[model samples]
Target: MGNLVGSWRFKEPSTVEECDSTWGSDSESDEPVAEDDSGISDSVSPAESERAPGHSGDTSPQLSDSPESAPKMKRSFYAARDLYKYRHSYPNFKKSRQPNEYRNLRFYLNKIPLVPDGIYIEEILSKWRGDYDKLEHNHTYIQWLFPLREQGLNFYAHELTQDEIKEFQSTREAKRRFLAAYSLMLDFYGIKLLDKSGNVARASNWQERFQHLNESHHNYLRITRILKSLGELGYEAFKAPLVRLFLEESLCHNTLPNMQHSVLEYYVYTIRLPATRRRLLRYARKHYRPAHAFLWGPPLKRRGGGVGPEGGVGAGSSGIRAPAPTPEQQRRGEDSPSSPSASSRIIVSSHNAMMCQDLAGGGHKGYAGLGSSMVGLEGTILMAGAQRDRNEYNEIVPL
Candidate 1:
């Protein structure tokens, strides 16, 4: 089987200068000693480490730097730091038998021949590149192919480490393999990653891809994870174009249909950059419609006597006002602005028809204000009768 590859405050370390000068001192400090990256420090001997309070005096695990049996590791502060710094490159390393993300990564880069499950990385990559059925059905391979900092669902594979991430980024071979994997996944999603221009565009197979997308709800989640992983890795530059393509397909061209509004909301939010997120939100606002009733509201008034999506009073504009009453209409004097208590008159909004229907029943309490406008969920001004829920004593109280 193809194996799916899946700040603690430390005590302040003494500076290298301090460690160099104070090495011969009589005082013994439990804190980790600092050293340059020139292998192990000679200040603390293995005999002293074994005689220390927390040591078991047994031979420590050997990390093979070469084919020959490496030196026995000691349990000291400097030793611990060394172990942490060069954790990834250690030979004969084991962590409960399951391969770490670095091992899986090495497999993919062809550094190692096969994964823990005995499947060759090339064969796994080949299957991933063309096998849509396996890609859709197999859940474990995704974490291995596109590893991220977040924990994955594959229990058989270990979580990614910072050392592993740096290794992947620094390796030329790994980056090349990553781009190939990215291109493959893009093709699977009906997107073509243009090799020459480094841009993304709709593939010729979009119709077939759309059928696959609509057939299962899991595909939506997979797309979300793919986007997140892309952003988490060094491929953030590829996100905006892909997102724009998705928006255009779902909203403008209507080619990719039946995309849930909620899923689109999350998909857009997965973009890491704030400016990119805001720009995409603006794009979505142009084409997207709110499914939530609370999010539905009238157009807001913009500055300079213009209307906006989020309601605001125009410059020098009179506040919420009741309609002008005719001669025959002034008989009841319900909405007459000419009345003595004109501020107390109920000023209804023509655009608040839906809001009126929501607050139609008599159990709600009415809140009357002179020039105050109630802002709805989408920032639209509610110029109609603003309401509040009655308290336990049946009294209207402001929250």
Candidate 2:
């Protein structure tokens, strides 16, 4: 797969001449050398050296070209030791090596193509979080996730450890959050984890679950979080329902202003239809009079205010919150009328919503898609236009 080149230093094996010069005695031997005593023997191993621990004997001689021939010089490194070399550049081989001082290192490296299996290798390695226990080491940590292929389903499974499941099973809130998050993950990434039942059941009914949450005043934040994730995943199907939730102030009226604002924001940034924009602006102005306090005021009616249904504005907020969109509403959003003029208007409105963010200047009172008769309602009349400045306030006339 790759080519590397570098010079290496290796120790030379000792021959009879080297041994006689290095280990000879001053006295001559009375006996002559034996005919078969060629002075060649097997090299001692590290284990054998350990057995004779205290002896100051020299280590085995460096491997030589032949058993009978001595080498030119003694070398420090081994002759057959495997080595590693990082090829900084190719073609100009010698100059690109790390350095001569780092030659003949006892390390090994593997070379792989920058692209493998038609995908960039870097992308595959990106999932490796390295190691958690050893922060300083460079060991790659792998999650036990695998792509499951069965029947007609093919999705990744996020495997959890026993300890993780134990902790998760103990906390009720954790289960709810995990289920909500798992619903999002299943919808977006085609990934799922085993539920409490340890079944591979798909979260097919997220809408109903969140709608039940809509009835609860306490779980509104979780519902909003789920909606936010859906919106980010570009699930355009949730637009009308999110808008419905946004207007259901009574459903989340008991929640904190921050939670309500998040819901409002998630829907506003998501639903891009021109009709939805008009509806949102009208509802925000009438019901949420403290526009400046919530950081959103009523958008001014462009050119003409003949956008919504002909009805009274204040009549709707009868302490009864609106419900999620019906099947018909969802169907309409999927197949709505779009004209060039309407698209241009939507673009303009979107630009305005982005720019007209300074709600602190003043509040603009809006009607809740109703006629002048709504202003006369006992519940909404006093609250109507209450956030509007007193100096320029005037009686709202019915159309």
Candidate 3:
């Protein structure tokens, strides 16, 4: 067994907002930028980040065999690995050298059946791709379907390696299989990934799939894993749109209830492009309310001064209505020093409102456990059985 370090090991971002705002410089490369709606010209070239090794249309300088080029190649690899920052710190800081488990992922990518079922990548995509029931009930498939550099929930599956990542990124067959796996998961989430542009849009059954997502809290972890895996596998181009869509629907449209927190905390930082991440952060800041203050990456500053007397510049003024104070408290008046009714107004979003309705109509039968889980913090839910990283893996040994 061998341990490899330097640039490949996952490092959690110390300050997420600070990291996102400056990770990738706009002048990093001359690659075309995706124009922001607000006409921001800031762009992080794909070559500087997720552009595959042998991908066509790439203008980045190629690595050479010369000793002088070695350092440049190393720097490029390091830049590529900087695509994501884990919310939770890496699993083991004491261990200097982490395990590099690549054989299983390599064999699996090459169409060899590593799992006990003897089912390979082709069969999984062709036969079991659309099987939502099997996907949900069967836990083993996720680790293989979305291989990560870190440890996953499935102990049976192997973690990724630098070599395996290169193979998946550069080789034609492995890249195709990777995209197929991504497409399958996208369909499962009721999203359609466009073939040419790599942009994602809502699938025909988005409503149905979204409703199911609200009903179940377990998939949130899966989503977090998927985002992390995509970042690791050089699919950073695909991550931004999906995350943008999630934020738009959940925060702005209110269509995706119970998803805002997970998306904001677990999904956003996985984006490789700095400009896009900043744009989404700005949007979230603008649309989100005081209820979500705790979730913001940077310290949310008070705009137009603090909450003033006469309920000015407060929750009431910002469209978040506070519950009517008890008659006794009201009679005591706003100036009463003894009044202890300063509890932050609980924002009953449409999802919570629906939960209330379900409660009124004879208990939450189908939506069992969702209401409680939704209210819990991101760390609480993530630490409980959610596989954040695959740090534990069998090291590679030379024969």
Whole-structure CA lDDT of model 3: 0.50
Model 1 global lDDT (CA atoms, 0 to 1): 0.44
Tally clashes: model 2: 7
Q: Compared with the true structure, what per-residue lDDT tens digits does model 3 show for residues 1-399?
A: 234432244343443333344213323232434422211111211111222121111112232333222211001121123332231222222211132345445554664664655667777888876788877777677777777655655667765654455555666767677788888888888899986457988999989888877655567667766776776566666777888888888777867757765576446766645566656666666676443232332321233223322232222112212234467646764666543433522333222323343444533342333333233343233323222321211111100
All candidates: CA RMSD in angstroms?
A: 22.5, 36.8, 17.3
For model 1, residues 1-399, the per-residue Cα lDDT tens digits are 223321122232333222121112212232323322221122211211121111111112222223122221111333222222221112122222223436646866876644345555566666667677876786666666666443445655544444555566667877777777778877887889986334888788888886676555555545655665555445656767877887787667766545533233345545444345445655555565321111112222322333323343211112223235566655655464544454343433322332433354321122232112223332132312432321111111000
Candidate maximizing lDDT? 3
**Candidate achieving the largest TM-score:** 3
Ranking by lDDT: 3, 1, 2
Scanning candidate 3 in windows of ten residues, the lowest lDDT window is 51-60
Task: Give Cα-based local distance difference scores for all models.
Answer: 0.44, 0.26, 0.50
**TM-score leaderboard ranking:** 3, 1, 2
Per-residue lDDT over 24-134 for candidate 2, one digit per residue giving the tens place of the 0 to 100 score: 221122232221111111111111111111101022122223312221111111110100000000112111122222111100001221111222223333332222222
Please, what is the TM-score per model? 0.52, 0.22, 0.54
> Which of candidates 2 and 3 is the stronger one according to lDDT?
3
Positional deviation of 119 in candidate 2, in angstroms? 24
